[model samples]
Target: MKPAPFNYFAPESLKEAITLLERNHGTSKIIAGGQSLLPLMNMRLATPETLIDLRNIDGMKQIREVNGFLEIGAMVTHQRIMTSTLVQEKCPLLAEAAGHIAHRQVRNRGTIGGSVAHADPAAEFPTVVTALDADIKIEGPGGEHWLKPAEFFLGFMMTTLQPTDILTALRVPVSPPRCGWSVQELARKENFFAIAGAVCLLQLSQNRVVDVHLGIMGCSPAPLKPLQAEETIRGQELTDDLLAKVADLISEQVEPESDLHGTKAYRRAMAGVVTKRALKEAHHRASEGRQ
Candidate 1:
């Protein structure tokens, strides 16, 4: 199927894009990579009257360090992130997650902001960002605003962004010393949507967990940080017994729905299993670095 008729605008600058969005308001949609939007549009599920393409907008494709965070422009492609030396050295978790997104063709065309804006529940970037407590930078006619990861995602396929706002960048905190990370999911193919997934981060001190952040995907309306599960591992020595307890806590916190990929019970069971494995792997990585 072909997309519905729409007026296209390719702005040369960020200000012009904002102006176009402000003028069109509800009638317009921002097109970054169109990896997700085009599919929806082709199906007539999203029929915006206008498309404000950001491809020509300069400065939105940059990736650099600002203060203590790694700032990634909204238009930066998943392929860039997957291969970035800066990203790999600073936030290996994000790089790892990016490597797992779809296939090389999709990653080459999919932008970070596009995926976040699309807000797929099982996407890798969103889950990683939420677990890392990253911040989203958005621009509009009034100027810019920042939103915490927790506040950025409003619902499934929804966000806190206003109609006129454009996501400009994402700010992820640089990995601290002794930080460890892991991402695990089940898919029929190498790049298919996860049946159940877990992204875990642990900050350790003298073999004990100092900080814990665990986010789950493929089991909720939005990528979620299970606070109860995180609390279960905080300050504890990561051991087989402790990991088992934390896994049980995670299982109790999430109620996954039955779907075509797997039964609800199966998904729930996998969630616990994967969470434990992710934590264990991350802990081992941290231990190896320390040694």
Candidate 2:
């Protein structure tokens, strides 16, 4: 189905885009890549009366480092993230996750901010960013502010953004030396949305886990970090038996709903499975002093 009639406004500056959004109020949609918003519009899932495009805005497509963090503009595409040396060096976990998002064509048009704002339960970026404790910046008529991933995501396909707000950038801290990260997912096809996924980051000291972050997707309303599971393995020597126990803890922590892609039970099971695999690989990389 075709999208309903809408007015298109492409602004050349961030301030202009913000003005348009404020003027349109509740009727406007801020579009970056249009990869997600276009599909939703075409399917009648979203029918905004006005579409405000941000592609022409300056400073919205940059990648830079600030205050010891990699600050990525909201307009950065998945393909850019996958290819950027800066992203690869500072946040390799993002590159690994970007490679798993749909296909090349989609990656070329899918913005990191778009995916995070879309907040799809099965999306990889949100899961990875949340696990990394990344910060999101937003601007509106009221001015600008920053939010942690948990504060930004409210529920499935929902965020804390206001009607006149635009996501400005994402700030991710560089991983420490010897830190290990892995992203694993189960999908029906090579590029389809994951049925279940896990992102794990670990720092091991003398074979004992010192710091760890765990995030799971496709098994909850939003990407979730099972604190119980993290605590289970943190500061402890990882073993098959221990991982199995942590897997069980993760399975019990998630609250997934049944759908055509997979049953709740299936998603829960796979969440644990992927988490175990991710943790194992992360442990290995940490042991090898690689990130």
Candidate with top TM-score is 2
lDDT by residue (tens digit), candidate 2, 133-207 = 899999988889999998988889999999889998999888877988898989889968889999988999999
Task: Name the candidate that leads on lDDT.
Answer: 2
User: Which regions of candidate 2 are displaced past 4 Å?
Assistant: none
- Superposing every Cα of model 1 onto the true structure, what RMSD results? 1.4
The collision pairs in model 2 are none
Per-residue lDDT value at 190 in model 1: 85
lDDT tens string, model 1, 52-164?
Answer: 99999889898898898999999999999999999988888898899999999999999999998888888998888888889999998889999998888976778888899
Question: What are the root-mean-square deviations of the candidates from the true structure over C-alphas?
Answer: 1.4, 1.0
**Runs of candidate 1 exceeding 4 Å displacement:** none
lDDT scores of the candidates, listed in order: 0.88, 0.90
The alpha-carbon lDDT assigned to residue 244 of candidate 1 equals 87
